[model samples]
Every structure is written in C-alpha cells, then in structure tokens.
Target: MGSEGAAADRLLSWDRVSLVIGLLLLIVGHYQGLFVAPAEAMMGDVGRILYVHVPTAWACMLVYTACFVFAGLALWSGKGKWDAAMEASAEVGVLYNALLLIQGSLWARPTWGVFWTWDPRLTTSAIVLVLFVGVLVLRRVITEPERRLNLGSIAAVLAYAGVPIVYFSVKWWRTLHQPFSSPATVSDSFITPLRLAAFGMIFLGIGLIGLRWRALRREVERELSAPALPAALPTLELGQRGPGGAA
Candidate 1:
C-alpha cells in the first residue's frame, strides 16, 4: 500500500506538471498567433482563430482515438482501469469536440457569411460529437459496473467508426470547408505557432485524461472492495403468523 500510494502520487504529480506546461505553451502560442504572426493573406486577422481551432481539432481526434484503443482493451481484458481510461478519454474528447464546433462556427460566420452550414466536414464532425455523447449517455443509464463497462466500451468503439469519416469527408467530397492543412499548404509564418498550439493541446489533453482516469479507477476500486448487502428476509402477510406461531 505504501509503494502503491507513492506511485499514485508520482503519477498525479506528472499529470499536474504536464498540465502546467501545456497551459504555458498555449498562452505563448496564442500570444504569438494573435500579435507576432502575420495576418493571413486571404482572411486577414480573423484567420488567427485557426491557431487554436486547428489544434483543438487535432487533439479531439487523438483523444477519441485513445478512447477507441482503451475501449478495445477494456473489452478484451475485462479490466476496470481500461474502462476508466476509455471513459476519461471520451469525456475529454467530447469537450474538445464541442470547442472545435464552436470555434469552427466562429470562423465560419466571418468567412462564409453564416454561422453554420451542412458542409460535409461540419456535418461529419457534428455526427462524431453526437455519437460520443451517446456513449456517455449510455454509460450513465446503466448501473451494473461490468455491464456498463461492456456496453460503454462497445458504444465507444462504434462511435469511433465515424471519426475517420469526419477526417476524410473534406477530401472525399467537394465541400466549402478547406482540405487538411500541412506544412506545405500553410504559410511558413503560421507554422510555428500552429505547431506550438497543437502540441500544447495534445499535452493538456493527456494530462486531463490521466487525472480523470485516476479518479475513475479509484472509484471502481472502491465499488469493487465494498461489502455486499445481506439478502432481505422474507416478509409475512398481515393475517399470517410467523414461522413458529400457532395457527
């Protein structure tokens, strides 16, 4: 127990350190993006949103991918920790997905003259959000831990099937949304801050998921360790006597 506690402490310390570093990087990157980086040739200053937006999209995809992997592990191993990890990643992914949609809408309004549209990228992204949200909802509705883990893992796996579609939608179909950005495609001036913010988001997501996973694992352990309630005694009818009573 002593060694286990020490290890847990070390893990939590690492998570905190990662979160702090991620936050610092994000602040620096966003500052550079907003002030130091050159305005885009086409969208002008508004294009700065991509610094955070693009990073968020990347982080969301990676987090969901982690959830998928964890879900598979939970299903195969029947382990509580794996299930906890899956839940944690799913939660973080949902948050990132929500931010992605909001940022996309903000970017869209000025560039496309509307807050939203049924563009293939946007549609698939929204579907991804809905599917993961359903996974969370399914987990909440189920009470039995083993059953919940099995079903939630299954749901997460199914939800992840849409992620690839979301990623490839812009390429597979002609849409208003732009294709995937790369170093070759984006300007040299924009790459530094974009990369910084992307790495920042990834680190932050890892920290958040790790912390959440620890909490969930502890909860599962407690549930498993707790003593089960004794079975209820049989009840007697109003007019009936006790087992030893005379009629």
Candidate 2:
C-alpha cells in the first residue's frame, strides 16, 4: 500500500511541469499556426490544416518511436518496464492517429476535393492504424499475463517495422497526400510553425506518455511483486493489456 502510493506520487512528480507547459504551448502553437500564419497562395484558408494535421501526424510517429525504444529495453533487460513504456506509448499513438484521420479529412476535402482517397500514403496509414488496433485487440483476447507479455513482446517489436515504408512510400508508390513537409522538403515560410508544432507535439507526447509509462511500470511491478490486494482495491490499469491480468 505504501509503495503503491509512493509510485503514484512519483509518477507526476517527474516532468509534471514539462507536461503541463508543453501542452499549453501546443495549444498556443495551434492557435498561432492557424490564425497567424500566412495563407497558402495555392490552398488559401484550408491550408491552415497543416498546423494541427502535421503535428498530430508527427506525434503519432514520435510516440511509436518511443515504443520502439521501450521494446529495445524490454528485449535487452528481459524486464517488463519496457513493455509498460510500449503499451503506454501505443495508447497515445492511437489518440494521435485518430487525430490525424480527422484533421486529414478536414484538410483533404478542400485540398484534394475529396475526404477519402486510394492514395498510397492514405491507404497505408489506414493499414497502420488497423495494425495497431489489431495489436491492442490481440492483447485483450488473451488472459494470462505471462502469455500476454510474450505475445506483446512480439507485437511491440514488429509494430514499428512499417515506419520507414510510411516515410518513403510517397517516392516508391507516388501519391497525392503530399510528401513529408520536412525542413528539406518545404521552404522556411511553411517550415517554421510546422516545425514548432511538430516539436511541441513531440515533447507533449513524450511527457504525456512517459508519465503513463511510469505508472505502468509501477502497476506491472505491483502486479508481479506485490501481494494480491482485496477486491475493493482498484487495480492500476495504466492501459488495457489483456483480460485477467497478463501482459
């Protein structure tokens, strides 16, 4: 009991201000990007979608990178701490991916004249989303923690394999979704706020998911090491792993 309390207390203590300030900066970046930036001579008002769309998409990729790092830790140490990081990162990845879908749709309608398309980048991203969802669902279907962890280990290692392909698919497949508007790909006029938004979202995601990851570590440690508490005590469900306490 005392240890659990200590863990919970320590979770937010680490990066508590960075998390709060980062989120506030992101909100500010969103406002500044949409309202303050100059309109695209080509896309006009709708081009403002880059403000939110780019950051959300960037956050998705950044969070997944965090997952890969955690997976490395887990694979190296054979400890569950890495698994916790991967799980928490994946949860936030889902949220950011969903944000990308919505923002992309809104931007696509004006830019592409359609909300949905068979463009390769668009198509593959949807596939990536499905892949992650499948991973999450697979975790839920299993019951035992040990078995779930084994399966999750496999999934975590495999999930980021699609990233490079996501990055270069535009060149390989040729699509209308526009290549990554990185500093090299775009002019400084467009690059400035987009970069800021991306960095903001990245820091924001790290701080956010990092906190969740710590909680997950504590929870998993408790589950494996702490005594089974009474039924009335709530479990530290940092994020869903699988049914019946495994993973």
In terms of lDDT, the best-performing candidate is 1
All candidates: TM-score: 0.86, 0.79
RMSD of each: 5.5, 10.9
Query: Candidate 1's residue-wise lDDT over 1-247, tens digit each?
Result: 5686588778457778888888988998999999999998889999999999989988888999999999999999988889999999999999998999999899999999999867666667788999999999999999888899899999999879767766576546645657677767988889989999998999899999988987898886555454787877665555554355423
Candidate 2 lDDT, 1-247, residue by residue in tens? 6775675577456557668767777777777777777887788877888877877776787787777777677667656667677778877787778777777778778777889766565566676777777777876787665566668757866877876676477446654556556668766667767777787888778777867877777766555465666567554665666446632
Model 1: lDDT equals 0.86
Candidate 2 residue pairs that clash? 145-246, 145-247
The 0-to-1 C-alpha lDDT of every candidate, in the order given, reads 0.86, 0.72
* Model 1, position 93: C-alpha lDDT score: 95
Angstrom error of the Cα, residue 221, model 1: value is 2.8
